[model samples]
Target: MKRIAILGSSGGNLYNLGGKEPLKLLGEIETQASSAGIKIAAIQFIGAKASMDNANESTLSRLYTWNSSEENIVFSEEKALKEVNGEAKKVDSIIAKMIEDGKVQGLVLMSSDPEGVNNLSIKAAAKKDIPIVGTGGTSMATIQSMGGKVIATSGTTGTTNRTRAVAAIQSLSRHWGLKYKPVISSSGKSSQNLDENIFQRISFRGIMMAAIPGFIAMSIVLALSKIPGLAKLNDAFDLLIKGLPVVVAAIAANQVSGLDEVGIVAGVVAGMLSIDGGLIGGLIGGILAGILAFYLIQLALRWNFPGTTANIVAGGLSGLISGLIVFFLISPIALSLGNGIRYIIELALNYNSIVAGAIAGLLIWPAIIGGVYHAAILPIVLLEMEKTGASFLGAIDMTGLVMVSAGITLANIIYPKQKSESAIAVPGFLINIAFGTFVEASYPFMFSDRLIFIGAILSAALSGVFVGIFNVKGTAYVPSVTAPALSNNALGFTISMIIALVSSFLITLFANKISRNKRNKEA
Candidate 1:
């Protein structure tokens, strides 16, 4: 067994956008390691990502003691800063202990822009000459400037950086002749494949930074479309929401897939062609345009005349050629598909509010578990938010998450005997729900505690009805605590949250009481 520690800030001062994305990174690594017959000795996190606000005494004590745990309970941002002079002693001690105990062999630092000082372990690892892997250009630059001995440094794909980290460590392990079972590898996914290796993962992120203006344009409209009595402007806003993602994605894709420079003009062309396609059309058009432009640029580069302006000329020509071909050819099909998808979703939502919420709650888990839910509905939610200023379906799904968390918290209060489990799942899940808008914490309980699962779904449906009744609105494809609180419908969101928590608590308590009675009867 060998291990590497992943450390980072709270993702560029926010919770999920930067380092915290690819929420599935750890699980993917674990599965790969398990199949390869390698054991991950420990995966500890440090810094702001591990912090909790106004944490209870028990969690605080663990932070104070710096006791290690598999979960995030043992670390705290405040504790790290206030108690340790902005040093990463907890991180250092944890890794040092693991290495001393022959548990882990290396460290991989998930990077942040501007770099975070939460892990002073770079100097410590360098002193011991341990291999450290780092991500993010800014962080990697700092590591190099400081002469740290990290074996590798590169940009990470926002979605799949975890795999990169594990692969890097495995590369390090091979140098040491570490014995581990062989895992089947995917074809064309090795470090040498340009598309999978360098382009999508590293280049896409770098290029996307240039699309910030386009992003803000799309973002503000999603929020503004929620304003009341703006029906006349709905069509125009719809076009913006539908068009902008493509505009940004196209330019980004061109850089990632081809020419090595973002093409803003080409993106605008793709956007204009996909006027009413919303999120889905934008994604499809952008990706298509990128691929087309890439090949076109490749053709242009064959001329081989060297000049500083060559890239720009080649890129612009490719954009025009690709944009014209893609939009004219695919626009019709994209529009139909977009409308078809929207119609199906609207049909489901048009059902009774309670029924709609219940349907969404019941279906959400399966969709999430299968992983198709994100691809299928993110566009609809975003488009709906853009057109009507709300997504009842999205809200319904989110209400269930918070409700389940609150229920578990409430159950712990009523049933002290369950304190151990409660301590593990309560705020941990709630924090994710708030920050990442993730709702996976209680999913494991489906097999272990059927009653909890059922109660959570139904109770969350009730809260979803609350969302429907009040017409609660969210600003984006994902639902977060911040979205509603910052929305024009703040009061509705507040009430919906309260209803969700109380409803979930009561239902869970009732379910538990029934289970107890059934056990007593069986006895």
Candidate 2:
């Protein structure tokens, strides 16, 4: 079992601007690793306080051996100051220990911090030949840009990150055997200190760049897939649309491995699966193909068959074997899984849709927040949409979200202090709540105050009930509230939206009072 390492956060304000904290980031990474059956060996991080104390200490930083419990991790500036007078080498020391330990196969530097403890990782890679794979940290970014051959990916979503961890495992495992892969990095705000560099931010813009291809694919596919006039080209567009996830995932895996050749071969395998099973299957197949390709290459490398021609022969043969594996084994499984999930969706719809709506409404927040929703759940909804020309889950998901959000925003406007503090709330409440189904706009209120979130659950769930009761259905599969408006029973959807809004408003009034009372008492 190859164990992966989780390095802690970036030191300063860049940390604040970046998405999740290092602790949370590590936990997510661990989850991703676990889901794939990969074992994580260690998680270590230097706390922000250590840098503030103008000293680093072994005691102040935290490390977990095999388990990540609260008891195992510790961070304190005072602890550093108390234990060490000046800068301490605990991070470096731990890196050294990880290298010395035979079981700790690789490191995933999770820090967004550009400086501090990661310097040790870089030095260890350069001199002692340590195997480190970074996902989001600035340290890895910096080295990769400087012409260092580091194996890393800037994975923003959980599914993508899971693929990234697979890449890390493969690269690290290969590295331990030969230590030949060069130290690579990407430039981003994932550093220990607050440093504003234009290039770093620009390099992290790959996600934005990747989105262009997806949007183009979606636009062409959407225009081509649904229209009977374009039926002649429907298969071609469906191929492009469904195959996009495999292509995207393959590209990301290649970037992380720096093995474009293998990624290309794996992508072919994944694309074939997409033709059979659609997006979800393609994604799963893409991952398997990518990992298996690398695994094949690693096996080839171990053979060391004595010539420059060996790589070509080995890689070609490996690609053939990998393709066969994907075709014979993965494709059948993927098709079966797709059928099973569709049946599960049917069962969910059959099990009292109001309850389903309530469940979907409640679960959507966490799923979106955690990002697993996009990878797994949303695709299920999308598949249902494609098949039925509508999705009960999608309606349950979006209508409730929009109306309940509108209610919450209206409630916020009624509050003097809350409205005054956030100036933007004064002008754009209606347009944002009604129009924007990104749905995260409502999150600020929830994160700022959970009472609001609790209130929101009630309204959203009620909205779900109304949507189910009305048997609201959509013809055009769209993203949010507009989806229902463009549906077969537009009035039913609209009425349900209004019902949710009213319910949210009335319930939130009481919830707001309870919240304020709790806050006042706490104060």
Candidate 3:
């Protein structure tokens, strides 16, 4: 039978606000699980003595408690608050163990707070590819942020909490192919229709997270290989670079399958086969493998097959099929597309470097915001680096995008309409200049003023012209301050960055002055 775990904050906002009995919630969950043919393998109550008391009172089997109390079993609000961090860690550990041992295939979470314990548990389940249904507080919002499904609710009353929780559980049950009756809210609307798609299920964030380590490793190896004894390491690093597609595929598969072992195995096989197709092929193959393995595993569970036998069948079949399809059908096409894109980019750069750079710089902002950078541009950057040892496009991103963002934030600090906003910009500016990451610091300023947004993009394009004229090229996604040293023309790249910074700063300063004047006039 499919097993699930229910985790909740005891004596917290859920209980404090609604004055609901925890026992009744447990009973309701059990009732739904019984009707859906799912087993409640474990229930964890997190908080203080009230949680321990609830755990003890729970008639349901396999009850666990992460209480703040040590010797005494009395609930203390202060104690629970003090031990919040420890309790959250314990919750994460327990859930991770349950997922690792395959004791639970799904999770039900109810919490009033979005952070602390709830966030940790959601992360653990996400890492393991377990389905989660949540209610109360910001539980649904948090789950949705991680790209999980949610059933919306209108209020935070005890009845609404129970209704949403039951509906979410019923929805999860239906997803798993169990016999489930749709739960309807007081408005007579089926809870299934209330589900919202806040984020894509594919998880581009996870893909980028997985790819970063490989890029960092490649950068480090390339930088160190120049040292006398590290000459041989270049060959090893080259091999590692070639296997980047496999790395990306493995992580993509895990994200897609919530770390299903069978799905992961299939994804690895597909990625290996799609080596010729580059990162693009591996990504596609891994996604296909994960999807195929997930459905096959579900079918096996429905048929009551042994777990080991089911995993073997699903992994073997999915891997073979996905690998074969990628190798014969997809790889050639992917390779051609990748080469064609690279050829076009090279042609553009050759035809008119200034115009090409300006266009790329102008489009980079929208692409980064629109989720196209990781899905499209990043692979091309990696491919370019693999072939040429550096990327011109990478240089443009560092100078035009990264430097320009830093410049705008710096401008805000120098000419602040409000000191509070400038103080906030300090950290963002430092981070951008120091580590060359998280251009989002400039976002608030850009979003607040249309002129600043337009000025930032135009300034970046102007900087890109300088980068193109100087023929600057470097490793992408590195610390901006240090990025210049990695470029083909370090001095020229530095000049390009300076141009971007100064131009954006001047533009932002002008915008800030205008805004300040307008605010004064309004006052």
Number of the predicted model whose TM-score against the real structure is largest: 3
lDDT of each: 0.50, 0.50, 0.67
Residue 115, model 2: Cα distance from true site in angstroms = 41
Worst 10 residues of 3 by lDDT: 190-199
lDDT of 2 by residue, 160-216 (tens): 222333345445555555322211222211221101222132221242234234533
Query: Residue 227 deviation, candidate 3, in Å?
Result: 4.5
Rank order (by TM-score, best first): 3, 1, 2
Query: How big is the positional error of residue 3 in model 1, measured in Å on the Cα after superposition?
Result: 33
Clashes of each: 2, 22, 2
Per-residue CA lDDT of model 3 for 1-523, tens digit only, reads: 8887777654444554332455445545655565566766666645434432253432222223423234111222334333554544566667667777787788776663346555555566666777776555455676767765443322233232334344556557667877654221322123222112111446665675567767656666766666689799789778876787787777776556532445567788878988888777887778777666656655654454433445665666776778778889999898788688778888888999889888888888888878887777776776666554567778877887888899999998999768888998899898888887778899999888898899888988887888789877775567787787666677888998999899989999999899889999999
What C-alpha root-mean-square deviation, in Å, does candidate 1 show against the real structure? 14.3
lDDT of 3: 0.67
Clashing pairs in 1: 226-389, 242-278
In candidate 1, what are the lDDT values of residues 261-365, reduced to their tens digit?
333444555555555555445555555555554444334323432222233443455455545554567657766775676577667656565566666666665
Error of 1 at 13 (Å): 31
Each prediction's Cα RMSD? 14.3, 15.2, 14.0
